[model samples]
Target: MPYRILKRKDLIPGQTILMVVDAPMIASKSRPGNFVILRVSDKGERIPLTIADADAAAGTITIVFLVVGKTTAHLATLREGEDILDVCGPLGRPTHIEKSGPVICVGGGTGIAAMHHIAKGHHQAGNRVVAVIGARNKDLLLFCDELGSFCPEVLIATDDGSRGHKGFVTELLKSRLEEDKEIAEVVAVGPVPMMEAVAKVTLPFGVKTTVSLNSIMVDGIGMCGACRCTVGGKVRFACVDGPEFDGHAVDFQELKMRLGQFRTEEKISLEKFRGQS
Candidate 1:
């Protein structure tokens, strides 16, 4: 039997699917920051999405996804009780959280789903977690209240100042750092550009920073090498090596280029899909 959808939500205009599958192994073993590869049907393309929430007792995992492509949009059309043809593990390396000091978690756009798990983990680790979320505007921002509940502080920012801060999330982090000296580490999950901005802000301060890369992933296993990323002049695969890495060591320029390699195709596909709808 395939994985069945237990629930589905349009969280902030994006598709959020909560699926219940027979993978007791995955739910029992999943830790925060781990992701899974899913296929809607045998002919569907593989896409990677982070686990927003999980309940091991019930053997369920919640995956919140932003419908950004043909596959994702197709996935959003699925309804509760429908089954995903293929659902693979508990993939990617989990982030290590500890009560080291004040931790700031930053998320942008659809990255909130990924950040929520980390924020929860940090809070459980007894770290004072400050969650900062941003989007182009209010509509694109999701999981603010949910993430806020797990963090010591929650800051919202938009490019247009529609919600909280007028500037970017990095600006908010910068101001917080200026006002307080206790920030020990920063974990960011979002678009490559946003993570790069936050990394630049934290680099000079010597604050330990980590970022989760969501570059296109095919096989969740490292064999495909599709999710390859460069860090400290060494190439690594995001799937097996890490979806998380030291922010300071990541070559953002190269990552940005790689992420944009299919921009035109993606845009055309999005446009064609939107036109169909």
Candidate 2:
């Protein structure tokens, strides 16, 4: 059966949206890091989204996404009561939660939605949760208050100084780490460059860090081999093995190159989509 969108709203006008889907099976089983693969229509490409929240008792899964690409721009046009042709999940491995001390959850851009779940999970697991979220400007920012609800301390950063600290999110993380915060573990989700920067900053501090990778994924399962990446000298699939991995062991440089391989095709696809829209 198709998953219906019970509710939908713009978190950032024309840019990002929060969608509540009627997928009880996925909601009941989903964990913090688990994601879902959805198809807008029969011919639309499968778009993978991280589960920002799940209300099992209510039989709904919440997802947040930015309208940056063709598929996402199309998604923004959808309204409440519309149905997603296919939604196959909760897929991938769930995040490993524990009572690790002083957990820092870092997010940039649309990744803040995913980080919200991770930060809350850590807090519930009895860890001191700190959140750092950022965007290009204040209008583009998201989840600051939502994150504050669970995280005891929430920090903000923005590239244009429209709100919060006037710098990259990594700068805030580095400054905080330098202050001798006893951070036991970190969970980050963002653009590849942002995650790479977070990994670089934490590597010197000897802090355990995990980053969720939004690699190219065709199937919600491992059969497509589209979401493969190298971690600690071993090949791993983001769909089945993880959307999360040890930051220190990840080969980020290679991953960065792989993410850009379809730039030309993506641009052409986006242009065609916009024209048809």
Candidate 3:
């Protein structure tokens, strides 16, 4: 049976959308930090997207994605009741969720879209979830209402000061760290630089930190090695091993550089696709 788009919510007009697909097995098995690789058509390139939410009872899972390239732009064109060719996953090791007290989860930009599920997982585990989320501006921010429902406290920041604190999310995180909240652990997921900055800010406090890496992937499995990165001096695959890792031990600088390697090619591919259209 084809995986049908059960529901769709256009979040940022041309930028991002939330899709609920009919994938029961994947939904039942997926956990926070797990991702899926999807192909919109026979020739479509497989794209990895983190699971934003899942409802096993409904046999559907939610995925939020930005329309940055050919594949995503194509995916966005798909409307409700349309079918996606393949939706393969629940891949990547699940986040090591635990009862770590008073945890801080920081999500910058599109990362905030996926943060709610991860934060919900922690909240259900008895951890007080304090969320700090930001985007370049208020128009780009997401998940504040839903995340705020489960989390007793939610903090927001915007680069343009259209809504919350007028600065980077990292600046807000730094302020919270200084407040003596005894934050037991931190989870930062966003742009590579944002995650790196969060790790650096929490380093001096010696707070345990984990970052959900968004390294590019091909197969969304170990076979391709496209998502390989140096973590704790060992080669780790973001697909099979982890989408989340020890922030202090991860080599963010290396990951950052590696993420840049395909940008030019990606841009070219995007341009070519646009020209053809």
Candidate 4:
């Protein structure tokens, strides 16, 4: 069955889009950190997106994506009533949520949407959730209201000094870690560089840090060696083993290289797609 888009919202108007899709099976099984691989058309390339939110009762799953390449640009053109050709998921391991002490969740750019669900999970588990999110400016920030609805403390940062802290999210994170000695863990979801910075900030404190990696994925299964990354000394597949891993152990440098491998070709493809449109 085709996955139908039930609702659509332009979170950033042409830059970021959010879709609530009707996919009962995937919604029912989806958890924080789980992602779905979808194809916009029969001939389109498969792309994996994190389940921003899932409502089993409503039989819908929310997906938020940034329009960065050809497939995403094509997907953004779809309307609320359109049908997605195929959606295969609730793939990858779920985030490990426990009733620990305080937990800090840091998100940057579009990654705030993905971090929202994980923070909700921690809140539901009776753990104190502190959300720290950042963007280039107030206009670029996302999911602030959603996170503030549940999280006890929602901290924000913007590079242009248009919002809360006039610096990076890591600065707020470091301050929080220093003040709250009871912080249990730190979870970060965003660009590789942001995640790397989070890991670095948390390292001195020795706080357990988890990061969600956005690797180049083909088949959303372990069979394809495309999503492999080095965590510590071992190679792990982001699709099957985890999209989440110990941030301190991950090799962000290697992940950055792999992610940029297709930039040249992707830019050409997106240009051609736009020309056709």
Candidate 5:
């Protein structure tokens, strides 16, 4: 069955489509950090997106996306009440949450949507949640106000300091770690480089850190080897094993290269499609 687009918004100048899918059961099972593979048309490219929001009773799930390629650009053309060809799952492992001392949640770019559930979980578990969200600029900062509701303290950072601190989220994390030595766990989700930097900052201090990874995933279910990563010097598949991993142990340099593999092609696709529009 097709999923009806309930609403669409320009979240941080990109596209966020809130679709009411037919899979009521799937919506009920979704958790934070989990994602779904969606196809806009019959021949559309399958894209993996973190489940930003969901309501079981309403049988809806919101997928927030940045139009980065041909598929996403096509998806952006969709309007409310339009139907999508396919949307599968509630996939990937959810972020682990516990009342494990003070939790500082960091999110950047579109990763803030993924971090939303983790922050919500931490807050519900009675942990003191500090959400440090950053974007390139004020316009890039999405969900700042929504995420702030779950966090006791919400720190915003931007490269130009348009709306928050005048530095990267990693810089904010460093200052906070120095000021308060009680942040037991840190969850950083964003671009690979940002997550890597956060991992580096927390490594020496022995601060337990975890990161949400978006490795190359095809099926989003374990059938494909695309989402593979090395952890503890062993191979791990991100789809089945985790979209989350210990930041300190992850080989971020390798991950960075893997993500960069399609940069040239992706840029061309985005440019071509943007030109057509």
Candidate 6:
């Protein structure tokens, strides 16, 4: 069935778009770390996006995505009241949240939106949630207001010193870990490099760290093997085993190599698409 877009907003005008889609079943079933595979048109390739938020009572699931390729560019053109050709989800394993202690969630770029849901889950589970989010500048930051609503501490890092700390999110996280000895876990969702940095920062602290993988996916199920990655010296599928895994155990080098395998083709496709448009 086609999913209707109930609302749409440009979180970073022309670069990032947020959409609230009407998908009651998915919304009700969705939990932290779950994602959806959507198609803008019948001929379009399916792309997986993490669910930024879900309101079961409202039957809506929010998705935030960066317009990095042809598919996302097309999706950005859609306005409120339009319909998505297909949206199959609440896929992947939900985050493992339990009342342990303070949990720090680190996010960069568009991943801040995805981290919002997980941080909210931790908050609802009675865990003290500390959100550390980063962007190039204050204008590029996202979900600060929403995260601030529930989180007791919302720390920020901007590369250009536009606001908050004038450094990387890792710097804030490292300092926080040093000051808070009782922190139970650290979760990161963002670019591969950022997640890698988070894992490194949390390593010496002995805090359990989780990182969400945004692997390239074809089918939203394990059958495709397209989202396969090595975690803890074993092969696992991001779509089924987890989109969230032990950060220290993941093979970042392999994941980074795989993510870039199609960069050339993706660029060509986006260029041809733009030419047509």
**C-alpha TM-scores of all predictions:** 0.92, 0.97, 0.97, 0.99, 0.93, 0.99
List model 1 lDDT by residue over 1-277, tens digit each.
Answer: 5887887777755544444454566788899899989887677678888987788998888888876688788788788887777778899999888789899999988788789988898899999999999988887788878876777689999999999998899999999888878899999999888999999999888899999998778898999878889999999999998999999999888887787898898888778877987
Whole-model lDDT values for every prediction: 0.85, 0.90, 0.90, 0.96, 0.84, 0.96
Cα lDDT of model 3 by residue, 1-277, tens digit = 5799989998889897999999999999989889999898788789999999999889899999999898998888899999989989899998888887999999987888788889999999999999999998898989989998999989999988999899998889898999956899999888888999999999998999999988889998799899999898999998888889999989888888888998888898889878987
lDDT tens string, model 4, 116-192?
99999999999999999999999999999999999989999999999999999999999999999999999999989
Estimate the Cα RMSD of every predicted model relative to the unseen true structure: 2.2, 1.1, 1.2, 0.6, 2.0, 0.6
Which residue pairs collide in model 2, if any? none
Would you list the clashing residue pairs of candidate 6?
none
Native-to-model Cα distance after best TM-score fit, residue 61 in candidate 4, in Å: 0.1
lDDT of 1: 0.85
List, residue by residue over 1-277, the lDDT tens digit for candidate 5: 7777877777645544333455566689998878888898786678888888878898778878877678888888888878878888888888887778999999998888878878888888898989999988888887778887778799999999898799899999999999989888999989998999999999877899999988987888888788889887878888889989998888877787887888898888778878977
Candidate closer to the true structure by TM-score (higher is better), 1 or 5: 5
lDDT (C-alpha) at residue 12 in model 1:
58
Model 3's lDDT to the true fold?
A: 0.90
- lDDT for each residue of candidate 6 in 1-277, tens digit (9 for 90 to 100): 9999999999999999999999999999999999999999999999999999999999999999999999999999999999999999999999999999999999999999999999999999999999999999999999999999999899999999999999999999999998989999999999999999999989988899999999999997999899999999999999999999999999999999999999999999999999998
Q: Which model, 5 or 6, shows the larger TM-score?
A: 6
Off by over 4 Å in 6: none
lDDT value, residue 147 of candidate 3: 92
Clashes in model 4: which pairs? none
Model 3: number of backbone collisions:
0
